[model samples]
Target: MTAQANYNYSYDLNNNIFYSGERQIPAYELEENEIGTCEKCQSTILSLSYHEIDDEFIVTGKCSICGNISANIYGHEWNWISEIFISHFFGQTPAQTTEDSELQIPEARKSLKNEDNGIDDLELLNSIPMNQIETIFSPTEIKAMFARAKGEKCVRQYLYNARKKYKTFEDVFGIKIDI
Candidate 1:
């Protein structure tokens, strides 16, 4: 039999299924804003979602019951993961370990807060009637919906819209990245 027939959540023909060599995350390390309950099966989550390109975490040994879904936040996606570090693990950076600090960026969800909570104007929204609440998001799940009214998002758009707040590459993003 070929590798596909033997492939599992731990290994494959060309890749490791557990994704160990690159980033060995414990089953407890859930992705950002991905805790609590499952929206689909309503089952209590046994483990956290892995934040890898095209990454999938199976609830069943064969991934039968349900799975934790995830995506890559990069131009290259899966390919980019090869070049990226397994982040938010160990609480240690090249600088120092602020693991005890609760306000740390990785420790907070939706921590990169700007004025918009999809509630462009909270006062205006509150003044409206309940039936019109659909105009506002309920924040039931994911709290995620990209600003798709326009075309695909560009890094420049995020940079420009953010203004003076969007300072040098290092300040805006706590990372020193090279292209």
Candidate 2:
């Protein structure tokens, strides 16, 4: 079986949501300000498919006028839950970082405040030597490390769910992740 098949997740094209068993997970959508332009014929309509394991999106635009097909692959750092939840559901605008000041939403502002006060848990875990990681960090922190390594944002819900797989991570990595 493919590695992606091991994950019990599927996307609903009609509703634009992801499902892991019965759990409804957020899915990415084209932003109001964003436009999909077909390179070949300049068409505006496009069909997109997201590949979760690779964190890549395949965009296809078929021009009705010119009968030209345009396809592209977008990769790197794009996530469904984090992006959709913050941008769509919460109706929060993306933060803009400028030379003098950075404008962030309330949630991001809170996280920034916390980071300013002390080292982030994820950062600390990443800095620790691999040989000493299991010894230095707690099981939860270790799980967060694994999730981060897998390209997930270290959000609380993701971290909490990941912590339960501490044993699995330990077995795979041959490290004794402790509480």
Candidate 3:
């Protein structure tokens, strides 16, 4: 039997089937104002929307001011997660972190004022938005830094080459990058 004949494909566009990785998240279930910053202009004010393709949920936005665009992908499992938790997860982690710590930029070194939240100075430092980092380095270079942080085997050689040719992150960002 042909693969097409053996396999069954079903979609209910009439029922609004949008796959957020594994399941459908209807328009009503999408969250708004979950907080995102622009990649080009570093604006926190965004106009956002969510849609699903195959098995991925994509949230795309444009900056209200500069018109820069940014997007995020979510799997079906993420659909049920609370907005606050998603915000915290995306905020604290490097994967999709933003650089528009706009209000926090001037004092980026300061720990968050909220008491007993348990995020330390180092976490805060690492959490510095990528847009801010981009101010100091190109996107390709930043990718090298993140690759090094992720312990990729070949990153060391590339970063070593970068160090030989350019002022390293320590010199520009003012923090020692062990990786």
Candidate 4:
């Protein structure tokens, strides 16, 4: 039997090894050799998951940029849960610099308010880290996402379409998509 198999065979503390205890360890574990990386922000991984199936590890997670599993992380399992939940489920990724979210807009301050002078998307875009940008999308995929953004009729039409590209969304959108 392989070392992995041996580990599963028994929980012999005498051997200085332990079967990730239920409470002490995460409910799930890594199964595959590697998982994809994040679609947004290449800084940190978008998701990392593992599961013990038939006695082995299946792990997956992505970088902030492509949601492509660029790196291989080996260690504790639960450590990544928090990050996955925050980024994959929610759009929030850990900020690089600590900009106060609560900063108040100056009441008297006005930004040369004019129709042509729109808010600087480029400034915001520049401020956005390369890692935060969503990974690229295919023309068909882009069309589907656009449909969803349009309305519920589109959402229903694209719901299954979205699921079909489950892995692709992470690759392009940098977000975990579960239908």
Candidate 5:
């Protein structure tokens, strides 16, 4: 009879690694002829998997000697390899930069602000990060806010029509122009 070797696998979330007992055996290490090397132990086998969550791309794996390790490329730091991987694997276009989609305020919108109140919805939206803005505003409302901030014509009428099906601009966008 022939003997067999069995092994169990454990995953580390903070540092994505596959380990048995205390020894790390990342998938890359098992490759017949891999060129990548581990930075910690200088082992020529560190398996890595790419994951794009929200706004960050995380590469996780382990080394034979280092239990768990990972690297993160976030925001605009993504290189060509990461871009291609994220686009082809995740099927998502790279996220837009903060300045790329910023709302443009027209002089007309500036003149129409309630003279009694100095609140500018556009100004407020600009101050907060996009993540926070997304939490409180729906896509449609956000689009309308951009229009209103830019002093687009007929924004009041458009908002009036939208109010019937959705929350008021003040309630959704977290800025009170009338107050």
Candidate 6:
């Protein structure tokens, strides 16, 4: 899925937070505020329904007072809070995890090697918002970087070379990326 063109709240990419005017709003609060009132009449009485499309979750609210309907879409990364709000709205308990699992270093290493040999890196890079990518590197620079990284013969070396700029990508995009 592509990044949303218009969002209900403005996002501060540098700070990795959402805000409306001056007040900072968490994901849950932003979602709640979005569906809390009618867009046309500002009425609190709304009948809401949820839908999933690929990696996005959409909440549709119909205002009882003005009969105005609005739909808000959220990305998968915000599911941690959206799931809780969804469950509550539907009168269901949120799923709970038993314990945190330890990371398997060997499996991670193998996965990185596999991705290095395939087009996964390109795909992963494309998954990021184009605006964010352009902020860090131009199209010509990115093409050159990929060509240079692919010249490495060893899988470990290739992986390291390819991911050399990942830290910069993470810092600018405000998302943890493994590719």
CA RMSD, predictions in order? 19.4, 16.9, 17.0, 15.2, 18.5, 14.9
How big is the positional error of residue 52 in model 6, measured in Å on the Cα after superposition?
13
CA lDDT, every prediction?
Answer: 0.26, 0.37, 0.39, 0.31, 0.37, 0.38
Maximum-TM-score candidate: 6
1 versus 6: better lDDT goes to: 6
Error of 3 at 147 (Å): 35
1-179 in candidate 6: lDDT tens per residue?
A: 22332322233322223332344433322223335664335677342445455676555444456433344566876442231111001111122111121111100111122243232333234324445556666565555444443442344554454467667766644433454
At residue 141, candidate 2 shows an lDDT of 65
Per-prediction TM-score to the true structure, in the order listed: 0.18, 0.21, 0.27, 0.23, 0.27, 0.29
Best by lDDT: 3
Shift of residue 61 alpha carbon in model 1, Å = 6.2
| Candidate 6 local lDDT, residue 29 | 24
What candidate 4 gets wrong by more than 4 Å, as runs, is 1-49, 68-145, 151-179
Q: Over the stretch 4-62, how does candidate 2's per-residue lDDT look in tens digits?
A: 21233333433444444345544454332222553434656434333332465533323
What is candidate 6's CA lDDT for residue 46?
Answer: 43
Model 5 C-alpha lDDT per residue in residues 41-121, reported as the tens digit of each score: 576544355544444443434344532232323343654232111000111112211232222221112322433334355
Q: Count of backbone clashes for each model?
A: 2, 0, 4, 32, 0, 0
Report how far off residue 103 is in candidate 4 (Å). Answer: 26
Q: Which sections of candidate 5 miss by over 4 Å?
A: 1-117, 154-179
State the RMSD for candidate 6. 14.9
Rank order (by TM-score, best first): 6, 3, 5, 4, 2, 1
